[model samples]
Target: MEDIPNYVAATFIAIVIAVLGFIYYAVNTATPGKKNLTSSLVVTILVGWIFFVCVQTFNGYFTNLSGIPRLPMFVGLTIVSIIILFIWPRTRAILMEMPITTLHYIHIVRVPVEMVLWWLAVSRAIPMDMTFEGSNLDIISGISAPFAAVFMVGSRSKSRIGATIWNLIALALLYNIVKTAIGYMPYYFTPTGGEVANLGVFYFPYVLLPTFIVPAVLFSHLVSLYQLIFKKDQPQF
Candidate 1:
């Protein structure tokens, strides 16, 4: 981790902020009447989660490979929270009504995220497989996000189907990188790169990837999918 340049970490932190800002914007836009309450709630919850994860990481909770793995547990809680938000009527409505452009454009952050991953890989903080040079093809999704937003910006049936397909493909890419990351954790699986154990993620800044960035990206896809498949009329840009 020490070998990683300061710029990489700075870039990553910027990405995290960008993601959080986008989420706040999306929530605020979706629920205009309750924008203040909902936006504040979203920011508070996300900021609190990030702080908690940082404290845990500083305490060596996630780094301690001895007992049950804390990293997976932490990620599981996030997943469950997302599921609840999707199923809860009020929150679900916000998600369903969020602008499709918001969902699509937010993914642009993934481009810099992938670059940060590549930098980490170069520093040997993580395995190469987690970057574009290896198995993680998620950068493609980031690159195409703007075009996807423009291409699907109407109520056309074909556009909706096309957008749905793009979302699924992007979701699968996300899953692939996440799975690859888990396989390199020191809890159960052996490190993919002999000595590198994907431990950077258990540290500050990087911890934000699992707790905030990934979840935000995942939720965006889910919201977009729900809007495309279930909502009768798609929101225009």
Candidate 2:
């Protein structure tokens, strides 16, 4: 962890903040009458989650090899929570109200995130398998996000087929990286020679990758898919 450069951490922090800021903006613009209430609720939940993860990370809760692996548990709970939120009527409505373009644009953050992972791998803070140099090719989703948003989601676009295909492909890419990361967890798989522990994500700032960033990106993809498949009246732009 100490071997990783400070700028890497700084860049990751900036990415997280940018993601949160865009989320707040999306909520505010989507919810007209209850924008304030909805935005506040969203911000509070995200910030609270970040703080909780920070406390646990600092206390070495996730790094503990005893009893059960807390990092996986934390990830499972966060994913379940996102599922529940999407299932709940009010929350679902708020998320569904957010523009498809906004959801698509949110994925641009993944580019910088992938870069940070590569940096961490270079510093031996995490296994190289988690980066583009290895098995993780999730950066493709980030690089193509803007083009998909503009071309496939334009106001005069005829069909949602293109956007739907892009969403599914991007979602698959997300799943690939996530599975790779979890597979390399110390409790699950031991690293061999010349490889480093995947402990970077269990530390400060990087902890947000699993707790906040992944969840946010996952949620956006899910919402976009739902909108594309079910929402017939959704505007192209």
Give lDDT tens digits, candidate 1, residues 1-237: 788899998999999889888888888898899738989898998899898898998898888888888888888898999999988998898888787788899999999999999999888888888899999999999999988887775343248778888999999999999999998887756753366768778887898898778988998998888888788853442
Q: Which pairs of residues have clashing backbones in candidate 1?
A: none
List runs of model 2 lying over 4 Å from the truth.
Answer: 156-158, 235-237
Question: Per-residue alpha-carbon lDDT of model 2 for 67-114, expressed as tens digits?
Answer: 888888888898999899788998888777787888888899999999
Best by lDDT: 2
What RMSD does model 2 have? 1.4
TM-score of model 2 relative to the true fold?
0.96
TM-score of 1: 0.94
Work out how many backbone clashes candidate 1 has: 0
Error of 1 at 207 (Å): 1.0
Deviation of model 1 at 24, angstroms: 0.6
